[model samples]
Target: MEVEADEEAALLSRPRARHIKKRALKNKALSVSFDEKDLKDFVGGFHKRKKKRRKEAELLVQEAQRRKRIEARKKRKLERESVYGGAVPATDSGSDECGEDDEQDEGSELVTSISGTATYDNGDMKVTVTTSEISREEDKFPSEKMQAAGTQINWRS
Candidate 1:
């Protein structure tokens, strides 16, 4: 027991080494001690890489926005086509077709141009296009209601 106490006293009397914490380099990161010139070079390189990465990210964002706009336009076009029963409307001149051409024109013809007007009131100009089916020649241009409202409708030749 005296020998054990002596050993314990010796152990306790010994000067202890201070605990020093060692810093580990993070994953994929380098810890470097450099002179002033080397630090300037490192900082310049880091800034250049940061700028390049930022530019690339911006380009990717712009490309995604462009793709979204194009997709939206395509979707709108598809929706319009579906709403029109899969056939797009066609433009029509003032010329009339024979009854024999009705069958041939059914698949192609959609809405014919009935009338259009451009009104300029106090520098505020507005243009309006009116479209309708022109199956019969006897069909009036302005219709009875428009004519009754004193509207001057002109039929294009």
Candidate 2:
């Protein structure tokens, strides 16, 4: 009798499912839509889209390189301006460090030209080489210019 009463109490304590109201205004159906052509292209045109993106990225990189080259050129111009005391130096202008005048530099080219001729010998199968060099100022050498200029001509510069 106690077991039967316990079973009856347990059944009474269990909760039962309740039915939902069918006339709920907030619970409504959704109307979904999609473009079939766009969906198909998105799924199938992977390589085409990737190629276009790669080309755009390449153009961006090229533009960046061009900008970098321009900036570097500007920096070099600034450096040249600093070296030349805010003036753009001419090709033949004299330098202060060496103090070489263009007139003196033109005069100091002692060996103006050097030419050679090769004569082929048939009997002995030998070639005779004859070379001649022309000097502009053999008497007035660099020694005289060095004495007046007080510095050696830095041809390497």
lDDT by residue (tens digit), candidate 1, 34-133: 6999888988999999999999999999999767655654564466465455655465321122223333433443333454445434444443344443
lDDT of 2 by residue, 82-118 (tens): 5554666567343423433323433332233456666
lDDT of 2 at 118: 67
Return model 2's CA RMSD, one decimal. 16.3
Residue 44 error for model 1, in Å?
0.4
Best by TM-score: 1
- Tell me the lDDT of model 2 at 30: 75
Task: Itemize residue pairs with steric clashes in candidate 2.
Answer: none
Candidate 2 has a TM-score of 0.34
